[model samples]
Target: MKTQTTVRRSKYAPSVVTKNDLLELLNADFTRECRAIYAHAVYAERTRSRDEGAAARIARYGQETVLSALVLCELIYDYGGTVINNLDELNAVLNADRVADPGWAPETARRLHERAGQLRSAGEPGLAKRIRRIISAKKGAVPLAALVSGQQAVAGR
Candidate 1:
């Protein structure tokens, strides 16, 4: 049976989200992570010959995304939600189209942060915290999303 929870938009107004609703968001994020994994893999392979160091770094970011997806799976099960993997559908986009521009990752991270805040307000602090932990505030950090997505350069090129 699915359960619904309330999140306070304000003292006077509250919104409700069913467990399936949460699952929908989680699954969507899972799909996104899968896409990122594919994109990073393509990028890593493409950059391997030209810039081995960059390729390695991109590969590491892809690994981190895998870890993040696992965390989301755990959250899904814990909340009585289903984990769906639509890798085939996610792969429909061309490999070249999959690669993220430098700004895309950070913007995506910012949106995730917003979702985390919503989860927190909806009495899902643990899940929210897990999501938040994946985001990095430090500039030029390890995760590809945060590293290349940020505005500043890596200091020494």
Candidate 2:
């Protein structure tokens, strides 16, 4: 017997999710969180004296990102997944440009968002939604895509 609820649930199920897929997704998420923590801490250091409130908010988001990463670590382990051991390798694999330019924090967020969209397209909407939350937390002070475009405009000026 078919029910509307069952059909809806079936539509939303992750048809393509696998241990390997989850491992890759979690690794990418882990890298994003690590970089976000660094970026926010650096932002706080760079602008703390000028804008204490903003710096505090950014630092708080960084802490939240740490928590998210911890949750992700648990999820990955539950799925029999392994995390990257070397931070440099993680950064290089995820965002070498971010390492070269810490100011590219917003771009990093955008990149994560895009990656999440890809996950969604690949039938991993749950993971995509989680990644979106991380992106939102990372972009605590400003909308990441808007911030990046604004910076580009200013640079062009």
Candidate 3:
């Protein structure tokens, strides 16, 4: 009897993540860290599509907003800047956390906001509106559905 050889496939392949899968992954890290990463990634992707000038501006703003949020979260836990006062100190802590895993840089946050402003001023009101909606949603300032009404009101004027 002759034996046939079997072919083996590589174990690595791209995997798709559903909304629930992403939610589950969020549980793996602290909520603050998760939120920072999510915001940073969104900002990065948005800036990546812009021109150099626009990209730089958006990146700056994005970094600022995300860093601000992170700092706010820390303050909420540590009771109002009792521990850290400046971005440098905050960055030191963030850098350490990033070494163990991955995190956003302050610069990245700033650029995102700048790009967003550029988009708004460049007559891309629809895109700007979307960005504002995303920011508001991420910051929990308003509900996703309510964002539509808010945008409509602004656009109406």
Local distance difference test, each candidate: 0.66, 0.59, 0.39
Q: TM-score, each model? A: 0.71, 0.52, 0.25
Predictions: Cα RMSD each: 7.5, 8.0, 18.0
- For model 2, residues 30-105, the per-residue Cα lDDT tens digits are 7666665665466556447765665566566557756767766665565567886335644443553353254555
List model 3 lDDT by residue over 56-134, tens digit each: 4434544554554554344233322122223344453344324223223333333334434544444445544554444
Ranking by TM-score, best first? 1, 2, 3
Candidate 1 residue pairs in backbone clash: none
lDDT, model 3, position 7: 56
Query: Residue 23 in candidate 2 has what lDDT?
Result: 73
Cα lDDT of candidate 3 equals 0.39
Using lDDT as the measure, the top candidate is: 1
What candidate 2 gets wrong by more than 4 Å, as runs, is: 1-18, 89-157
Best by TM-score: 1
lDDT of model number 1: 0.66
Arranged by lDDT with the best first, the candidates are 1, 2, 3
- Which whole-number lDDT from 0 to 100 does residue 11 have in model 2? 37
Clash statistics: count for each candidate: 0, 0, 22
